[model samples]
Target: MPDDARDLDAEVRYAASPDVAWVEGPDRVALVDLRDPASATPQLCPEPAASLWRAVAEGPKGESQLVALANDVVGEQAEALVAAFLEALAGAGLVVAT
Candidate 1:
């Protein structure tokens, strides 16, 4: 793993809150949050976010493992990107960090 994959926090898992629902389209996946009826943040994730979510779909995963997986799929800079995506997912209550 690259140095950028270091200093990661706890493991995270895909956690779908009741407030949000997952929607899968022909070409992409999306999340619909019921918290705000009018405003919807696009859940159409790119690259490692989609892959990372798939990784943790079965269970929780450490940041390092996730980064490694993303790195394998998306190549360079995947660690930083996956970390950031995980943070956003956690913040949105779509994932749980433990």
Candidate 2:
């Protein structure tokens, strides 16, 4: 894992970015960064990603809690799944460290 991933795993708490506009659909969730016009095009998230998004959106949650939540959705893949999701959300400015 990269240093950032390791640091995230070490106890970073995260929550959905206030700048993100969220819309939930029947099968997927759409996210757009209100602060970034380039991201006016929504990013549609499916399945586990949507689940993780909803969880973080509710409130700040630590890495372990997120991994456990992912475990409920993806079994043994929880750790990697969470890491990837967090990285993607952070990169997209859809999630922020709290």
Candidate 3:
């Protein structure tokens, strides 16, 4: 976890790269990033994570900007929420921060 919000670059974009595919079923929206069809498991982004994915798809944005955009969905904890969301996505190798 980053001690400072600025430690997280706001210019990073969520790269739903070509290697990943988006699937929207009646009950869910998931991103399938399979490193190997026979080995790596696909990751599922539910609710806010799914929402965040959609937002990042618009373009590269900073943490503050993401929080601001997600304010209605998250309320006062927007900053923390956005940061955590980005962290999780990055950790999953679903997004790249640069």
Q: Pick the candidate with the highest TM-score.
A: 2
Tens digit of per-residue lDDT, candidate 2, span 1-98: 99967875687799999998888987779888889687488789998789999999999888888998999999999999999998888877789998
Q: Write the per-residue lDDT of candidate 3 for residues 48-96, one digit (tens) a residue.
A: 5576777666566666667877787768877877879877777877766
The residue ranges of model 2 lying beyond 4 angstroms of the native Cα positions read 1-10
Q: Give one digit per residue, the lDDT tens place, for model 1 in 1-98.
A: 65544444333434445566666655456767777868977577554477776666546677777878878877898888777977787777777654
Give the clash total for candidate 1: 0
Among all windows of 10 consecutive residues in model 3, the one with the lowest summed lDDT is: 9-18
Sort order, TM-score high to low: 2, 3, 1
Instruction: Give the TM-score comparing model 2 with the true structure, all chains together.
Output: 0.84
Top-down lDDT ranking: 2, 3, 1
Clashing pairs in 2: none
Residue 50 CA error for candidate 1 (Å)?
0.9
RMSD of 1: 5.4
List lDDT for all candidates, in order.
0.67, 0.88, 0.68
TM-score of each: 0.64, 0.84, 0.70
